[model samples]
Target: MELKQIIQNRRSVFPDQYNSKPISKQVIMELLEAANWAPTHKRTEPWRFKVLEGETKINLGVFLAEKFKETADKFSEFKYNKIKRNSKNAGAIIAICMERDPEESIPEWEEVAATAMAVQNMWLTATDLGLGAYWSSPGLIASIGEFFTLKPNEKCLGFLFLGYYDGPNPERTPNPIEDKVEWL
Candidate 1:
């Protein structure tokens, strides 16, 4: 697929759309390679991806479910079940992170922007590969750094859930750019 079409066609495919088939390690490596090429200011290269698959994904589900149970005043069984289901259903879950520069030379936001670009690259690659993918930001995501054994300067941004999907590619209708953009 062409780059323009890939960018416009990319959609947030949820776990329910995912099939049970596993994704090959080579494809995941290609996605990471694409992410690694995203531009970073001052060469900070802040993006860090921690991938979870197989039994480890179940462990992630357990960890998240337990965290939600502890935090919610009245834990909704529905939400808890969905979290557990999504984690196990996904072929893989990649934890997106940003390791801040200790020197603090470049602004913190730049590092975040760089990380986002990296994710965008991954997303586009997934779309091209006919894989379903979505970036999810749960309320308890920030606390994942501890579970992932991240350094003090590193922070979890979100998780990219990936899996094989069947059926025709979904179409997207985006809002016009005029409303959101302005000429100087």
Candidate 2:
């Protein structure tokens, strides 16, 4: 598909059927490369990624299980196990983060914004490649950001779950431009 078409076709699909089939490393690299090209301010290029797969996926599940258990909402063992199991089924899990800049005059929010843009590039590229991708914050685990052992200046933003989708892609519903556009 054309690049424009791919971008328009992308969707956020959760409860996705993450099949056991694996994706090629070459395709994964291509998607990351797309993320690397995202626009940045002062060339800070603050994106950082940690790729999780195989045994590492299971480890993350266990960690998430423990983290959520601490809260009073009390997610059930079944729901907790579902996340653990689904995580393992994904072909790859990418943790997207940003490293704060102390010397630069730009605000910290912009750095995180740039990182988020990069993630959009990744998601679009994955769509172009016919892959199913879901970006999850898992706030319960991410809120304490320090637990990830980020560099003194780094912070976790979100994670992207990538894999082959076993379901149909839904059509996009167009919104009228006037609703969001301003005359100013």
Candidate 3:
């Protein structure tokens, strides 16, 4: 697919829209390889991924539901169940993480931006392959240690839920890009 087509077609497809068809390991690896090529400043390839499938995926859902119940000021069963269900429905869940530069070679935000770019690469690749993918950042991400460990400098950014869906890509249109830009 052309870069413009892939970029424009990419949409955040949730687990509820996904079919039961599984994403092959080879395709997952291809997405990761694309992520590895994302631009990084000062050579700090900050993006790190922990892929969860099968029993691991189920465990993550259970863990998150329990954590949400234990932490929310006023817990809603609906939200709790949705979180759990989404995790279970995804073909695979990738924990998006970033390891900060220990020497502080670059601003922390740069590392975060680079990590996000990596996810964008994965998203575009998923779109090109006719797959669904979503990057979800929940308040509960702060407590992700309960599910996945992180090094001293590593932190969870969010989770990428990837899967295959039966539905066609929904039509979407964004406002003209010129609306937000001002040429000097």
| CA lDDT of every candidate | 0.92, 0.80, 0.94
Off by over 4 Å in 1: none
Tell me, what's the RMSD of every candidate?
1.1, 1.9, 0.9
lDDT of 1 by residue, 52-110 (tens): 99988888988898899989889999999889999999999999999999998999999
Q: List the candidate 2 regions with Cα displacement exceeding 4 Å.
A: 143-148
RMSD of 2: 1.9
- Report the lDDT of model 2 for residue 120: 94
Q: Residue 29 error for model 3, in Å?
A: 0.4
Winning model by lDDT: 3
Q: Against the hidden reference, what TM-scores do the models get? A: 0.96, 0.90, 0.97
Ten residues in sequence with the least summed lDDT for candidate 1: 139-148
Per-residue lDDT value at 39 in model 2 = 95
lDDT of 3 at 89: 95
Candidate numbers sorted by lDDT from highest down: 3, 1, 2
Ranked by lDDT, the better of candidates 1 and 3 is: 3
Screening candidate 1 with a backbone cut-off below 3 angstroms (N, C-alpha, C), the clashing residue pairs are none
